[model samples]
Target: MMFEKIANKIGKYTVLLISLLIALILYPALEQYKIGHICLTLWSLITMVAIVVSLNENKKTSKRIQLASGVLFLLIGTLLTRQVLGLSQEFLYHLILPFSFLFIAYIIWIILSSIFKRKSLGADELSGAIVSYLLLGIMWGLLYSYIEFISLNSFSFAAAHDIQAKGSALFYYSFVTLTTLGYGDILPISRFARMAAYLEAVTGVMYTAILVAGLVGHVGRHR
Candidate 1:
């Protein structure tokens, strides 16, 4: 009962935490402060925990899976903080990106399962849909970052910033592209980058369609 209560609390707050992350991504000016990276890292950890807690409420996913995801997220957060603080980078920080993306993808699966397992859509289910969309964008952003890192000039940002700021730039660009909002400030130059952008754009459209269809079907069936 205590665990259920905790899960419920986390589920209720999922939307608020996600909104904060989106706010930070949209307003990069807040990231200029030294504390900005810390905020982002901490927020990421909490979000991961909240997601796992909410998923556990369904009892469909195993405890081992949840624990693994939580540990992976915690590790990524720790590595991110260390990288930001210049504490450690010997183990290759970029390598962690792929794992983080995988973890996010798994989280999306859990959220989707939870959403469809219900007979009727509630506020939590709707919020989970939004979170899944956001996670998709974030996952693609990590892919873009990895591509750019491996191949120079893969993507270009209009705003001039240091190499360290590329992560934020790619994230902003990914969301813009995901929403099909071509701001033209960031351009994908390489073939891989262009392909990724195109794929994500299509995926976004398809995801919207699928989510709406699923929700409508569920509502109709229940009604």
Candidate 2:
């Protein structure tokens, strides 16, 4: 049983490490190639599926099935702003693939929170985990959006078309909103885009208030 658990941890971390390496190094290097793009897509799909599967429980499978909803949430979130703004299929190809990878990374964070919850959490751990999760979500969202913007930005755009850069400027924009350090340089181009920005900002506020408070509450009431 010990060996089984250790092996599982190793497998999970190995995939995560590879995902990070590819996202940070390999993808950036070979980003312009068709084969590189295909490899990235395959790597992301594999990583996402592996993460969803990692929630496996020996006794009950349904509890783990909830993990699949993580994948669903990612697809919905990406497709919402993506399709609403009517991005090109070629751009969608690059955007959805990398965004999917980052979303899985976010779900992995959710899994970490679940693990922390199962262990003993003091007020410090509670505060740290809540802040970390919020920061992580915003960070991952930015990365995925940056890739989108990189693929979309063009020189021959009109003023309206130029605003597409703002949509793709997700990494820079999301953080500014999350930290409430709005620079106002990159504005939301469309209603769907504005809605996403609003949701992210609201998420930033509620995350601190709700998750942080819940952690403190649990710690305060502990036996």
Candidate 3:
């Protein structure tokens, strides 16, 4: 009974989480089109709506909604400034970084709150847990991009073509690091970049261990 109640409470997030996963997965292909940034902006708006709807039960719901609105507005404004006004892409990236960090932080907080409040596992709970892990990889990818923007040559790419260590490349690197796969296709040379990579690797291992242990315990109790 308790598990069902908790699961129902968090079930609202399932659709949103699935949407986020789809968006991330499609992002690389979307980049091939000229309207890719616009599509990404639209996805952000959709995700924001999902977040607001899912968190309607929270105490600061109004504030979170407003925050999401602000993020959308800023993202749109940034996109227009870059595309329409012919601003520097570098400047636009810098402007968007802080708000991006804030938005991702808010998401992580919400997911962690939902996960920790659960006394038992359910399908929704397991899905949320997995999404949270993916979110960590996305967050680190953004951080890696920011670092690359600030300090060029932080990472080396082993691709045949000359690839910039930003965007999908860094995102791929982030997930690889998070999983501790160490494919060696992308190498972090700078001190800070190396530090961030190792930290993500450690976090990935620890988080998986803890999640597995918790799931096992829950199963044992249920049995």
Candidate 4:
């Protein structure tokens, strides 16, 4: 029982840790250190573990399904780490990375849905919701990365750097699009890229409004 409680805490705080990792990766001081690879590897591993742990905590899910999700995440994490370590070729990024993000995004969606269905709002619910928001940005960021990787001209940046040259810029553009900021520093040129940007913008606004209202209603009922 005690061990399970500890695992639950880890699952609850996973998003906060992930957010910190993102900041660490983006920090200019660490740019010279090439921390992106290590940080991203760790981030992916932790996300897998967190999702598995959360699945274990939920009584509604069957043991078999939980075990399957764990196994799937494990396989994806292995591939992701290998790619990050340079043991795998660029082809892995073209294939494995996008699939990995898609899988994790699905897991995050499940976790968020479960949290939202809870009868009362707690720290876990609030944190999980925020994590879901961040995960949306991450998912879209990976998609943009893939788009830029496949076609150098998919997006235009003011600095005119390739996606590999300034990897963080893709993530920056992701959040900018998510919040509908449209800074114009980076513009999506491809039809699909523009469509994705618009979709993210709409989803971001709706998610924020719905989550805020739901949390407020939960709190009010308890009060």
Using lDDT as the measure, the top candidate is 1
TM-score of each: 0.84, 0.51, 0.82, 0.77
| Local accuracy of candidate 1 as per-residue lDDT tens digits, 36-67 | 76666666676666565556565546585586
Tens-digit per-residue lDDT, 1-223, candidate 2: 4433643555444444444445545644444554554565455555445444554543354354455545554654554444445544444445554554455455545654563455356443443354355445545455435444554442112244333343334544666677667677666655555665677678678766876577666656664
Candidate 1 vs candidate 4, lDDT winner: 1
Error of 4 at 116 (Å): 2.5
**Candidate 1, backbone clash total:** 0
Candidates sorted on TM-score, descending: 1, 3, 4, 2
> How much is the lDDT of residue 50 in candidate 3?
66
Of the pair 3 and 4, which is ahead by lDDT? 3
Top model number, TM-score = 1
Runs in model 1 deviating more than 4 A are 1-27, 58-60, 80-85, 88-91
Candidate 1: lDDT over CA atoms?
0.75
Candidates by lDDT, descending order: 1, 3, 4, 2
- Model 4, poorest ten-residue lDDT window? 24-33
RMSD of 4: 3.6
lDDT of all predictions, in order shown? 0.75, 0.51, 0.74, 0.69
Q: Can you tell me which runs of candidate 3 are displaced by over 4 Å? A: 1-10, 61-65, 84-87, 160-165, 217-223
